[model samples]
Target chain A: MIGFETLLRWLDLAGIAVFAASGALVASRKQLDLVGFMLIAAVTGFGGGTVRDLLMGRTPVFWLRDPALLAVASAVGVLVFFTAHRIENRFRALLWADAVGLALYAVLGAEIALVGGVAPWAAVLLGVATATFGGVLRDVVCNEIPLLLRKEVYALAALAGAAAFVLLRMHGIWRDTALLAGMALCLAIRAAAIARGWSLPAYAARRD
Target chain B: MIGFETLLRWLDLAGIAVFAASGALVASRKQLDLVGFMLIAAVTGFGGGTVRDLLMGRTPVFWLRDPALLAVASAVGVLVFFTAHRIENRFRALLWADAVGLALYAVLGAEIALVGGVAPWAAVLLGVATATFGGVLRDVVCNEIPLLLRKEVYALAALAGAAAFVLLRMHGIWRDTALLAGMALCLAIRAAAIARGWSLPAYAARRD
Candidate 1:
């Protein structure tokens, strides 16, 4: 039987790969060269977890502890940058990849936060932050409005998923089962939002 | 003699206040209201130290542990936001305030890193991060280029200060004396750079 830790680690790596690919696509869109692509990919892949770990006081960040992940992210960036010309609709591609990463990250993040002794509510926030902040950092670096600041369904999905996991744990559910349920919810909501072009409400500035 | 820890804490709070003031000025320029002013000010003042602490595995975060510093930063934000119109040459004012924050943070940050058992080089990087990351986050949120990314003498001053502090400490100098020397060097370099408009070299994209 695979240990829970091993299983979660694998899923986390998958999340990182998908996020890195999406970041590379963004770099291509911005017309940045090799350096930009690698930088963005690394930031997106490790950024959310880095922020989460820092906040949780987990020393020697994941990437810094295991630099192989960074090398993997860099490889993905190079791959995407070189093959971007063959891809049609980079934004669409990024969204699809990002959705997968979000689902995986939502579960992994909440689990880590809970294990680290954070309260449920803050864990949910950390889960959402862990799922979204990488893309946010990528956007900021590329000089675009961060998706977190936009009225998007992205952060909402992560929040709902994280909450679901925490709620299940509160009800004595097994950790692995709860995580799987959370991932499903995240993926479902994100997929629906993408398909239906869903968005959260925005507050317009008053002219009066 | 005041305990070294107490003196350092006081200096750190002073740094936060000055950085917060600069952040409020930037918020005013961006036409952000009260919430934005406070948010920016808090981030600009504490962001660097928070990141440094997080990286060093100093959990609960400095501001989160002791909300008093945040209160102080918010107070500065409130004061600046209310009196922004009355201030002449806000940018000039921000520059000076930021310079003071930079010097103080340079000393405090390196000291914390050394105390935290981090390697000397990493501690220096942490010091530079502590001195500059707040401003970097402020620029990102405000949709401006980060000061660190530009060819500025700012980060360089912090780096130099941090290195000097570490070097002096390694040579068996008194901690308080080393910190003072480091702060002075950071202030003098930053002031000169500001007065002469000195900058590092920019890597412009080649126009082939």
Candidate 2:
């Protein structure tokens, strides 16, 4: 049987790999060079966790502890850089890949905070941050309007997952069970949102 | 003798306040709500330090322990929200205010890293990150091109200051003297860059 720690680490790695690929895909579309691909992929892979770690006071950062995470990201960046032209529907592929990362990261981020002794509310916020902030960084670097600034179900989906984690833990559910449930809930919502073109209300300011 | 720690704290606070104001001004330009103003200001005020501390392994985050930083940012947000229209030459004022924050934060961030046992080279990078990242965050949230991403000498100025800090410290220069010199170097460089319209070359990618 795989230890829970090993399982979690694998889950985290998978999330990072997918997110890095998504970021690199965006970089490819922008005609960024290898440096841009590498940088964007690393940032998109680690951005959310970096913000969460900073806020949660987890120092030296997760990526710093594990060099392999960055290696995976760079490898993914290289792969995408060479193969992007062969891939059709890059936009749809990016969305689906991002959704996978979003779901996993939302749950993993909250677990990190809870393990670090943060309060439940703060944990939930960290989770949402972890799931969303990376994409925010990617979009900003690519000069795209950030997803957070748009009226989207993106952040809300992460929030729902985070809240579910907290609620489940409060109800004395097993952490493993709670984790999977949270991930599933987020994934389902996000998948549905994509399938249905769901969105939150956009804020329209008065010209005057 | 005046303690270096106390002086740096005050310098950091001054930088935070100014950066917060700059961020709020952007929010006002966008006609954001109070919440938007507060968030942007706070992010601008503390974003650099937060990143620095996380990298340096300083936990609990500085502003979390001391509420004054957030309070200062929020106050600045309110002030800007009401007075933005009254201010003449906001674009010019923003450039100057940002210059002040950049100089102070450059030195302060380097100092934090040095005190936290960071290597000098890494400390210099941290310093540049600390000085420039708040503005980067502010621009991203404001939907503008980040100054760092542009062909500007902004980050170069911070890099100069951080290098000065490390050099001075290495030479056994008095902490206060070193700090002042570093800030001066950064400010002068940035001021000259602005006045002369000096810029770095933008990267052009090859399609092949």
Candidate 3:
């Protein structure tokens, strides 16, 4: 049987690939050059984890320490650049892949923060940030309004997953079980929101 | 005689206040709420430094270490919120203030990286990133294209400043002399750009 660390590592790479692919698809839609595709892909893949590590005071960041992650993200970007046009429903495909990546990153982020011995609330916040911030960077760079700042359930889903993981860890649940469960909860909420057009109430600005 | 560190600290606070005021003015233009003003102001004030420290492996970040920074930024945001509409040319005011902040931050950022023993080339890049990234964050959050990515000489000015500072230091110039010279160079370039509409050559997308 594979150890928990091995499983988590594999999932982390998978998450990075999916996120990178999403970024490349955006670049394709924008008609950016190859360099733009690769840069956006790499940044979207590792941006969240980089932000998380920085906030937690982790040195050198994850990508700087492991070149493999950059290689994987860049390769995925290239592949997506060629194939994105072939897909008829590129936006839908990107959304589903993004949801999967979101769930994976959210849980993994929480676990990393917890292991770092940060406070539970801060860990949960960091996890949500890690899962969602990469996409924010992607959209911002592409000159689009980030989905997170919209009324969408994107950040809410990540928050739920990270919060669930934190609560489970506090109750002494098995680590692997909690991880899987958190991801499942996050994905389910995101999937439902995507399917049913769910969104939080729009902010009503009050003028004094 | 005033010490160098004290001078740097006062200038740093002034830069933060100016950046924060810029953000608050943007929030005013967008008609966002008071909370939005404060949040955007604080984020714009510290975002670049936060990014620089993260890249340099500086833990806990500067604003976290000194809550006074946050207080100053927030206070500037509040002040701007109440006074922005009275200004005849708010956008022009913001531009000039941002130019001053950009020069100050670029020189300080390069100095910080060099003092931290970062390689000179990387130090130059970080300084440019430090000076311009907060404005990028501010624009992106406001759903506008960042001025840094446009054809303007914004980043180029910071680059010139940072590179000049590094070169001066390498030539054994006094620290204070190098700092002032760098800022002067950056500000002169930026003012010329603003007055004469100077910009880099536009990218021509090649069809393969």
Pairs that clash in candidate 2: none
> Which residue runs of candidate 3 sit more than 4 Å off their true CA positions?
A1-4, A88-90, A201-208, B1-42, B62-136, B143-208
Model 2 ranges off by over 4 Å: A1-10, A55-57, A88-90, A143-145, B1-42, B48-57, B63-136, B140-208
Q: Write the per-residue lDDT of candidate 3 for residues A1-208, one digit (tens) a residue.
A: 3787887788888899999988888898899988899999998999899888888798678899998899999998889777887752667877888899999999889889889877787678679879988987898788876656553478778989999999999999998889989999999999999999987543233343
Give the candidate number with the greatest DockQ.
Answer: 3
Supply fnat for every model shown. 0.22, 0.21, 0.26
- Candidate 2 reaches a DockQ of 0.16
Local accuracy of candidate 2 as per-residue lDDT tens digits, B1-208: 5577787778777788899988877776666655556668888888888878877778766765666776788798777766666643457877877898898888878988988898899999999989988878788777887757884689899999989988999999998889899989999999999889999777899797
**Residue by residue across A94-125, what tens digits does model 2's lDDT show?**
68877888989998899888889876776886
Report per-candidate DockQ: 0.14, 0.16, 0.17
Query: Per-residue alpha-carbon lDDT of model 3 for B30-68, expressed as tens digits?
Result: 665555566578779988988899889886667656767
Residue A127 in candidate 3, Cα distance off native in Å: 1.5
Alpha-carbon TM-score of each model against the true structure: 0.61, 0.62, 0.62
Better candidate by lDDT, 1 or 3: 3
**Chain B global fold similarity (TM-score) for predicted model 3 against the true chain B:** 0.93
